[model samples]
Target: MYYSTDYSSPIGEILIVSDGEAIVGLWFYAQKYFMAGIDDTVPDDDLPIFKKVKKFLDDYFNGLNPRIDFRLEPKGSEFRKKVWKILMEIPYGETLTYGEIASKISSKMSAQAVGGAVGHNPISILIPCHRVVGTNGKLTGYAAGLDKKKELLKIEKILS
Candidate 1:
């Protein structure tokens, strides 16, 4: 069964979901694809994983550059999973362009396809999708909206 808890972050309310052990979803309230793969959940709030995630988020919002110490099970197609794995490689305070990610996948992989995968990423901040920019290094197409994206980047010190 899926368990959930709400976390209040600097940006907004975030719903954190877990399939008992691994983190399955974390999304800003009302953001695109919020709880996309979750069907139902019991609001537990006391799970160990939830505690760890809350602490991670706490350090993250406080500019501590917290490490991803918990297990993640973001559900998606194989292609999207590949893209998210690449997204995790994006260092904090750095950004990668869609074209760059496409090239890593294949010389011929379209930037648009990479964009789609990034857009569907279920675990937002932890997955680092906000670190993706357009070809011109301009911020664009965050599922949580540009404002949240900008705030997250600012937290990562990527934006002044």
Candidate 2:
């Protein structure tokens, strides 16, 4: 069963889901692919994981680089999980093109395929999917809307 809670963030209302321990999903309300891998959920605003995620969002909006102390268990294909892990390595104020991510995975990997994985990222800001861009540093689609992605980059000082 999934334990869930809601958090009001600067970008939007986010639903944070956990298995009572590890965070399994977090998405902006009504975002594309929101809760893509989750079901059988019930709200529990006081779940410890929810409290930690709330604090993380609080510190993030307050411009603090809060450490990810709580556990995360985002569900996805192995390829997608690998892509998300590389996204986590992107520095706070930097960006990586989808092609770059593809190269990291395999020179044989296509940017479009990487884009697919990037676009399906369920954890959003915590997984740093906003840091992924198009070639030549152009803005591209984001599951939570490009506007939210831009706002997040602005907060990261990657965009001004």
Candidate 3:
């Protein structure tokens, strides 16, 4: 089960969904409402993970570098996990091209494939999928939208 909370942010209102321990989703309202068919069920309230995740989000929105020490058990295939792991390694205030990540993970796969996997990433900001950009340095398909992506990059000081 998942529990959700709404937070007002500089960019927009965000809906945070968690499974008591790990945040399952943190989506901007516009993007979230656009995909209306998906379920938004909240899990039980007694889980410690929910409180930890909520605190992390609070610190994050307050411009504090809060350490997110929770385990992220995102649902995905092995290849997707590999791509997500590479994304996590992308330090804050930095960006990487899909081709770069693909080459780093396995030169055999195409960069486009890596981009597709990234696009489908369930955990957004926490997974840092927005950190991935075009090889030419242009922002690409961010699930939360490109404008939000640009805003997040600017907030993180990676877009200056």
Candidate 4:
């Protein structure tokens, strides 16, 4: 069973999901691929992982960079998992282009492929997929909407 809870963030209402022990998903309400791989969810705000995530988000919104040390179990393919791992390495308040991530992960992988994996990330803010930009430094392809992406970047002081 997947335990879940709701977080009212500056961006919007976010639904956080967990598989009892570790977080499995965190999706911006109605965002693209919302609840993509989840099933049999039960709302439980008191879950331990939910509480940790809430604190992490609170610190993030308060302009403090919180470490992502909590357990996470995002469901995805091996390639997507590799991409998400790279996403986690993106420093707070910094951005990387899809091409850059592709090169870091595998020379054979295309930027377009990396973009697809980034877009499909199950956990949104926690994975920091918003820290990715286009090759020309243009904000693009955020599953949670470009406006929210820009807002997150601005909150992190990456954008003015």
Best by TM-score: 1
lDDT of 3 by residue, 92-112 (tens): 778999999999987698999
Ranking of all candidate structures by their TM-score, best first: 1, 4, 2, 3
Q: What is the lDDT of candidate 2?
A: 0.91
Model 2 C-alpha lDDT per residue in residues 48-141, reported as the tens digit of each score: 7788889999999887788899998889999999999999899888899999999999989999999999999889899999999998999999
Task: Flag regions of model 4 displaced more than 4 Å.
Answer: none
57: Cα error in model 3, Å: 2.6
Candidate 4 residue-wise lDDT, 1-160, digit = tens: 8888999998799999999989999999989999997767998989887889999999998889998778988899999999999999999999999999999987887999999999999999999999999988988989989999999999899999
By TM-score, is 1 or 4 better? Answer: 1
The global C-alpha lDDT for each of the candidates, from Candidate 1 onward, is 0.95, 0.91, 0.76, 0.92
Clashes of each: 0, 0, 7, 0
Clashing pairs in 1: none
Best candidate (score: lDDT): 1
> RMSD to the native, candidate 4?
0.8
Q: What is the lDDT of residue 133 in candidate 3?
A: 94
Q: List the residue pairs that clash in candidate 2.
A: none
- When summed lDDT is taken over every stretch of 10 residues in candidate 2, the lowest stretch is 34-43
Give residue 154's error in model 4 in angstroms: 0.6
